[model samples]
Target: MDGLLLEILTAVGFGVLGAVLFSAIGLVSGTDETATIAPVTLLVVMLGAPPAAILTFWMAAAVSKHMTHAVPTALLGIPGDTLAIPLLQQATAMRNLGAPHIALRKMLAGAVISAFIAVPVAVLFAVILAPFGSYITAAAPWIFLIAAVLIAYFSAGRWSAVAGLVPFTLVIVALQAFTGTQDVKLAVSYFLGIAIGPLVAELFSAASPMEARRMNRSEYREMTLAPDVKGWGGYFPNPFRVLDRFQTRATAIAAAISSATFVFSPVAVTVIAGEAVGARVKHAYHRLTSVLAVRNGVTESTYIAEALIPLIAFGLPLSPVAAGPAAPLFNAPPRFTVDAASGEVNNLHNLLSVPEFLLYGLLAVALASLIAYPFAMNYARQAAVFVSRKISHEAIIGTFVGLVLVIGLWEGGLLAVFVILTVGLVGGLLYRVLGMNTGVQFMGYYAAVLSVPALMRLLT
Candidate 1:
């Protein structure tokens, strides 16, 4: 009785705390989930929070951040985060139509509904996959290689993205060889590299005179504000009432599909889900709103599902989100560890059970719904105006830069920083010009570690 009470109390307390913190963070345009989320989650683990509390905190953070992330996407006509990219067209269209507020509401409503649906479904799916955990981990090397190509193909780069996997994998392999000589093995460095890659690439381009001239903006970007619209008369509105039968159904279906395919990039899954919905709806306005709702909701569902399913089922960083933003949950060493040689699972998978994940996962959505949903629904415009007018993109990037430096320095000192910079430069440039997203690059990192050696041995 006492133990159950403690767990419930812990869930509520931390869930609310995470919602508050992340909701604000999400409003900041151009914030990437991995750079912000992974480091903060690491802090939670390092501080010795209970595994259940930590899980709730992290899940709530993802949910809330994605919800508020719609603010910048809808109002500012910029991606709220990496996952917000797909919704850009839909969001911008709504913004032009003077319905940015409506876009924000539908986006949050879909998030709330799909998030609730995704939790139990993801937990059940994870439990179903749990017995095969050993086999999955054993096949991880090949799985990563296949996942790399598949994700790259689905990305905007198409065949070129798929083909680029070879050199990208080779780059990771070369870096690993160098780091091995220094007696350091790294994981987060690759993630930070990929996460910050686009920024680094843009900065590098500024060194050339012609490129700098092309990059410079002559004046402040114009702002568009739709007339503020009220929802169906409440702080918290029903998803069903706000969203038509088709929109709600589409959101639910997409969330379920996305939950199962956790290995794919969240953005890719989002794009696929959005496209699927977009295909069925013909009317431009309805299609626009429904697609935006489903896509933004996907941002929540995919992140939640990817993080939960991997931690619960395989206990390995098998999915891109799992391997990146959610890595510490599985393999933060000293406190939590995954054995490289033996394939041992000793993280939240070992720490918490399936039932626990379900309960806390739902609790996370509840907390986020209570705080982030209504807050986003009510104050999205105000928040959007504040960020666009007040915050500078440079400041946001600098904060993440400082965080990358701190965590890298702590891990392997100067060597870790070098690895992060090297990967970030190459990965970022590839991403900018070639459309090789971080998701593919993360898989490339995994393949270099797991599959390259296997391929070599088979050849031998």
Candidate 2:
């Protein structure tokens, strides 16, 4: 037991170190999830690290990545990942106003504040709901179905929601069918890339036309603290001034509710629930920022909570985000499976265990904030100057494209390269010509899932 505790602590230290290193990389390179966290975690796991260490490292990397990755999104027009897209409009606005620091401060502050609020809430929910584990397990399929429906409905809307449903169902069916015949595991990332490849390509193409206009000749800057820097004192805009910015009960309630549910994707929650809360507030900017922050908090919290719920309850991975990190922790396959006859899945690995994962997540959040806050507050100007001088957005984009190509090759061999190009063309047309959110492609992914099952049923 003592050894277990020691291992957990060691893992936490490793996590903090990994996060800081990744955060620095994210700031300079504008690379996100795939570039930063996945490879690092995979490497650690391959080294046969203890489960606790791996979990701590995974959560730490995730939390830390968000803290620093938001910098490019908030300061420049470039988004770090799909998760950071919601902040693009607001962050770009701030950047144009030469107050990119404001956007950075808001994102960093909100992340820290949300992490503080969310960790305890998640822990409480996990403890209270632990007793009903079996019941939750029994209802897993129904829960997933409902979650899928809700995500679809909210993402597309009621009338057009069917479009969303069809695609999701098709994807699942296709996946299941393909899995039965041939292994789809090797192609998962490639397929995911194909589904979203067009969107990425479109983004690059769109930026290409304006790239010359947006290029910065300045050097990149490092965040530095003012001589008067203090602990939490530096977090506020004004030390003595308390901004009632996020003081409303409704915002808190919405954030808490979203955190508890953990059903929809972060983007879905931000668009649906975030908009709903924004409509309720008085000041438009205040409401928008507050709701955005709340939504972001809920997204992060729910992601953490939902991952644990499945593992603690039925021992299944409920979401890809969870499975990605959890895979290394348990040394489990990237995919989960159930027996046909018993319909049961084995989830008995106890590497980091449930409580430890929860604690480590909390600790990572706290430690990341403690480190990031001062850097953001005091060194905003320096960081901005340094980044502008040292890094070129064009270089960043080239690096991203190269990485995507490598990932494509890794997933589907050379065939994925053509897949990416085809998708990129379509995505570019949809975004530039139609002005639609790229998320609509998610419908195609779902459709692929559903088609397989329907076909099987018909044939059988």
Candidate 3:
């Protein structure tokens, strides 16, 4: 009773704290999930935060970030993050319509509503899948292989993305072999490389005289904000009052469907849910607003669902979100661990039960919705403009790079540094030129370790 009560208090306190931090971070344009959340959660695990607090913090941070993420998306014509990329078209349309304020409101309200709906539904679905956990673990290696191919083929790079996985996988395998011979094994280094690939590539390009010339900018980025408009009279308004019946239905249904599909790429899910909802509506203006709402709602729903379902049902990093930002929750060694040798999960699955997941998960969402929704709703214009003018993308990238370097040094000194640079440069170029994304690269990393070894054993 005492432990459970402690967890409950921890969840409430940290959930709100995470929301407050990431809510502000979300307004900054260049910060994405991998760059922002992954490193933060790693620290949470390393610092020995209890399991319940870590899970709650992860969900709360994601939900809050996605909520305020709409501020930049609608008002300043920039994507809030990877998930916000799909909402750009409709966000741009609404901006042109002189209704970025309405777009921002709808997006926030939609997120709140979908989060409420999705958390309960995702937990229920995860419980249903719980009985099959052993069976899923037995086939985890093969499932990763197939998922890698499918995600690669469906990403923006298409067939090129699929083909690129071949070389990427081989590179991972060779690196593992070399590291193992030296009695060193590194997973975080590989993940950091893939996550920061684009930034590292940009840094490299900026160092070259020829490429730096093309990258030079003469003017500061300019942004125009629509006048603030408020429909509700109170400090915090019910989301239903902000959304119409059709919009509410679309957001709910999309959230429900998205929560069930924790295995696919989140960006793909965002695009599909938006299209699924939008195609049914015919009016251009209504379609624009509703689809944008549904898409942003799907972002929170999918991230929560994807992270929670896999953690609860399988205790594995089965989803892209799980394999990335939430990976440390599943496999941070000496603190939390998922044994690669025996398919044993000794992380959150061992610490928290189903009922606890439901309880803490809801607390996280409620805390986020309570804080982020009202803040973004009230200060969308001011926050967007402030972030546009004050926040430095260079400084954010530099900070993350420094963190990565420190982690690499902690792991294996010069060897780790070499591995990080090699993977970052090669992976960044592939990602930039060939369209292969971090999600695909992550799966490729898993496939190299899991499937390749399994294949070799079978051949032998």
> Which candidate tops TM-score?
3
Candidate 2 per-residue C-alpha lDDT over 215-263 given as tens digits, one digit per residue, 9 for 90 to 100: 4346654533222222234343431122245533433555566567654
What TM-score does candidate 3 reach? 0.95
Error of 1 at 206 (Å): 2.6
Q: Name the Cα RMSD for model 1.
A: 2.5
Off by over 4 Å in 3: none
Q: What ranges in model 1 sit over 4 Å off? A: 1-4, 278-284
lDDT of 1 by residue, 245-346 (tens): 999999999998889998777887898999999999999999999998899888888898899998999887788788678877986666887664446768
Which rank order by TM-score, best down to worst? 3, 1, 2
Q: Identify the leading candidate in terms of lDDT.
A: 3
Q: Mind sharing the TM-score for model 2?
A: 0.66
What local lDDT score does residue 313 receive in model 2, on the 0 to 100 scale? 46
**Any runs in candidate 2 off by more than 4 Å, and if so which?**
25-47, 77-81, 88-103, 128-146, 156-254, 271-296, 319-351, 382-459
Give the Å error, residue 402, model 3.
1.8
TM-score of each: 0.90, 0.66, 0.95
